[model samples]
Target chain A: MAGETVTLSSLVTWLSRFRDLVTENRNYLTELDSAIGDADHGANMARGMAAVMEKVGASPATTADELFKSVGMTLVTSVGGASGPLYGTFFLRFGMTAGAVSEFDGAALSAALRAGLGGVVARGKPELGDKTMFDAMSPALEAFDASVASGGSPAAAAAAAYDAAVVGRDATTPLVARKGRASYLGERSAGHLDPGATSTAFLFQALAESLAQG
Target chain B: MKKLINSPDHVLADALVGVELAHPELKVDHTNRIIYRGEPTKPGKVALISGGGSGHEPLHGGFVGFGMLDAACAGEVFTSPTPDQMQEATKVADSGAGVLHIVKNYTGDVMNFEMAAEMAEAETGVRVESVVTNDDVAVEDSTWTAGRRGVGVTVLLEKIVGAAAEEGRDLAAVASLARTVNAQGRSMGMALTSCTVPSAGKPTFELPDDMMEMGVGIHGEPGRHRVPLAPAADIAQQLVEPILHDLDFSGAPTIVMLNGMGGTPLIELYLMYGEVAKILQKSGIQVARSLVGNYITSLDMAGCSVTVLRADDELLRLWDAPVNTAGLRWGV
Candidate 1:
């Protein structure tokens, strides 16, 4: 399955599964946020994903770029917090990099993931030990790139990314937050898992599961 | 959980209904969730716009009227407004003299407003300038953090800079005045109780009856430390000492505001103000103008914040300018 590609339908499936994941874990995500930041990350992500589903349901996009762009815009308009702009930027930049492609081979999908990570960095400016989504996403993208470079299939690359994301997410629990509202806690922000990193890990998990099933 | 709101989902929309009924002088755009001055934009006045999460009442929204904010965009409770809403407000409020965006220092507000300003200028060619207020001295300035949180000083900055814009100052002048006000002002807040977000349906934090959170942000985020509850006089000292330490308020006429978080009562606010005023007097700080009440507030968080602005004759004159708005009205 080396150089295996993911179709537009697979991307849609991944998003649908992600929507469900967020909806199921809304309370958990918000609970994580309560410890350090404002307790609304779960609700915000759920609301944004609901809006994304509605928008895509009404006008389905044929190309990968168009679909992701619609998802990004919906989140930007509806989410209303730091997550909204950060996740919105990720998908928006991903769409721009994909540029109307109908499917993504392992290499092409890796590039798109890299572009999304770039967008998050540009918007949030989180450092490696900042305990933000960047902690998870930065490593996940690197793992994906390495897997693809070794001629892995899309599923194999996504699995590599997912494993790296979990490690990154767990690493955030002991570090002091260096960005966003959580930074207000200073030393107090430690001992809690970063909500953004947790959600980002879920994203890669959804990607891996979807590609594996395909 | 036990709020006057109908449901967690309808809080913002339903509140707008009340705002429309309460203030006939303002126009409510339900679709975009923006509140505008009822009066049309003047031909040459530089428009002032500010907005943030909805829970901070009478702020950005209630201040929308003559000699204040020309438009205010409302986001969800404790959430920053989107760029599209801000871009729309910017275009509608601009009257050929450009527009000034008064933003708070929160990461979300800063990023969204920055995006809106770029979009407004790129799409419509309307000149736009922005000033982000980072007046909360509670959050220490560090290389790793997002700087200070914008707090009570925002209320003072909006009023002063809004008056400057109303005087027909251009965008550059108004933006410059806004920055100066932010530079001269400092704020510190403390919370007695944490407020619950409707969606979360629980208090953001639990402060025991014997303890209080110091240096709290408007959203009820934990402050610098938690100390045992103290008398109003002691609380005033705790809040005032930080502002004074952060900046030298002596040798200048100052405007002081003792603002309550929403759940705090007026009587308690007045008592707090008396204590704060006494401290300022002893410190050789001349209180040229004073405001006390729930001007900017957290949603039902029982707390108070103090703001001190080192003012001059010009700012005092601007403070005395005629202004009429739902949240604040005097000299009208």
Candidate 2:
């Protein structure tokens, strides 16, 4: 079971788990934002993910492409912030790369996630140490690719990605933000964990939880 | 938070209800959270559209009327409105003439407006031009960042560009004017207290009674640095010096706005303006015109922002032209 390919059911579970994580850590994310950015990241993410789940529940998708496209569009409409577009684009690109498949093997999962990372970069133009969600997502995707390259299972790759995501999220605390609203604070932006990076860590955590449940 | 509303979740909706009730000249699309002028967009005249987060009252919505925006999309407080809402507004406001999107320079706002423009263009082949206003000097100016926050100059731009659009200028002329207004203007804001977002249920940040935030953002984003509370004169100097440094205002006739950030009273704003006037005069900058009030605001954050727009005869004429809106009325 641990080495099984990811199914559409697991993808649904991943989204559901991510919603729970965002809802639980809503205040924590907003608190981090209040230090150096606007204090709406938590509420935005929770609301966006909830809307995604609701839409997915009402009209279920049979393939990975259909599922993520719906998720992306729902987030783009419901969440009205930088996160909405950035994260929405990520899922949209993931879906585009995932094609109309009933299941995803380790390599397919890695390729889909890499496409997602590319989407974030294209939309936000984030770089290393910019203290955005990209800071967590970039390393996490790299770890995902690394694990798959070593002939690991999808579950193992997810766990590796989550660990790397946590490390990347932690690394953002000491960075002076050079993007988004936090960049307005200049040097004062240091010593605060980026809200975007922290939420992204939850994303990897949700993926790990869903795949590890196998 | 102790706000006058039904609930935190219904704040934007509830506020839109009030906007609908109070102003019959403007039509509120409750489904899309957009406010449009009761009258349709003229057949040949270019239409103007602008919007952002909702907490800043009487901004995009209040400015929808005879000589201002044709439609305004409303988002949640301190959040950019979604692309669908904007695209709807764009389609509704577009006539045979094109529509111009006047966006503020926030990451969310720019991205959302950009998406709206693309969607509208693809669907209806409507010509759409977007002008992003980034006049706030409080932010760091680096290619790496999102640049400055759009603050007070937006109000001035709406008035000036709206009149030009009313005069039957094409989309290119109107958009060029909007860009000129943005490039020639500069703003700086300082907060005496933190504004509470209704959903957050608490102040965004804490500040001691004896301290204040300089270079503060409209959404209570902390500014360049916190400093001890100073007298109005010193604060005015802090505000004016930075703007003056960012742009040379002395070479041209200027239109100045001393705007409130919601909580500050009229007396205090006038007092602050007095100090600002003295500095401008001492600096040998000729101020051709001035407005003092809570035009663009942050909710319940007691502070003021100053905007200086360099103007020529054509711009001053546009500024003086007939206008009618919930927020600003002149020459009507």
Candidate 3:
């Protein structure tokens, strides 16, 4: 398990898978957002991810850092909402933490995830239970780290993170929003699933499915 | 669903064509979607830039010209502009004195502008300062939210602060004036109907014919509450009271703007302004200046918002300065 490593190809596959997931669930995310947000999360994310896919597909970025940085820049320039900066900063920090390495062992992956999450927290300033992407992202990182510490494979750790993300995403329902446009709803923000947490869950699920295929 | 648009996807691009054609004084960059003053920023003068989603006509973009914003970044309908667009605009708008970013208090706009400011400074070594306007008193400033929104005050702030920048004030003084304007102003908006985002191709929310949303944001987000529709007098009271209660506007001479929310007619806006003016007079708030029209708006949302900026001699002087822009113009 300690010797199992994820290659740059897996990273590319992970992003492609996430892009498809976002495309498939575009309307669903928008519908969730309509309840409490500006009702463009799905459309914005889909557009941003499509641009990211195109850029990453064209670039010959063999290193993990180069790949993630390209993805980050694409999202930052393409997506024009909270999702743009939050996800863009996440990947930028992830790339910076992963450095020029072309591959990531379980330990390296855990550290990169932590770094990405830290970037999100710094950019968005969301506290726990704020019903943001942080809700899902925070738990997913913890699960990934716990699985890696238990000497699991990258695929196993991703699967663990995906499961935790799902739970965290679902828990956003009935919780009031405290950040982003959804917070404008105040008490009405409850009884609705957070669009950001839902999309973040898809991100981890895509990661799990992509790594497992390898 | 029935809009004059060629297609949902082409709305912004097609509209920019009209914007450029209509306003020859502006330079529209179609690729980056930034609107700049045809005339570059004067040397040693602070430049001002403001932007947000595109549905709000004449806001950040239409206001870019002499004595106003030097540049404006345009995003997709009801979405914040991307950082690259802001970075480019920042670089181009900067004079030797530096640049000031006038941002609305939406989360996306704030984050993107912050990133752009940082990038512009690091990459190009241009000095950048920013002031975020969050004068909407309707949204309670609580721990769970991003605080009050930058509503009608943003329009007034841009004009007043833009005048200050035009006066050759340095970046710090201009930025401070912008913040002071924001602190001295308050706004409240209401909506008779929800707006349709071009991409969404439907109303953001459904409103009953008999009910109206109060405390509405510019993006068609639902307001604080919905109640049975009332007369213009009652509606004006609803809008003005929240603003007045939030701040004591009685003593100072206040600048008032009755801004239309895109779909509302000028006649209705004027009528709303009349009602609002009556209320202010009764409350002993002296109106130093008044503007009634759509300056900031939601896309095709039928409503009006009231903005009151408490003014002293200096603010009034700045407000009286010549301004030449598509959305607002006086003494040009």
How do these models rank on DockQ, best leading? 2, 3, 1
lDDT, model 1, position B205: 89
Flag clash pairs in model 1: none
Question: Residue B213: error of model 3 in Å?
Answer: 1.1
Residue A212 of model 1, lDDT score: 89
lDDT string for model 1 (A1-214, tens) is: 4238799888888888889999999999988988888788898889989999999999999997899999988888888778888999999999999988888898889888889988888898888989999999999998998988998889999999999999999999999999999998888899999999999999999899889888
CAPRI quality level assigned to candidate 3 from its DockQ score: medium
Off by over 4 Å in 3: A1-3
Clashing pairs for model 2 are none
lDDT of 2 by residue, B242-301 (tens): 999988887789999999999999999999999999999999998998999988888889
Off by over 4 Å in 1: A1-3
Better of 1 and 3 by lDDT: 3
Q: Each model's C-alpha lDDT?
A: 0.91, 0.91, 0.91
Candidate 1's displacement at residue B326, Å, is 0.2
Question: What tens-digit string does per-residue lDDT give for candidate 2 at A146-200?
Answer: 9999998999999999999999999999998898999999999999999999999
Span of 10 residues, lowest total lDDT, candidate 2 chain B:
B139-148
Report fnat in order of the candidates: 0.60, 0.63, 0.67
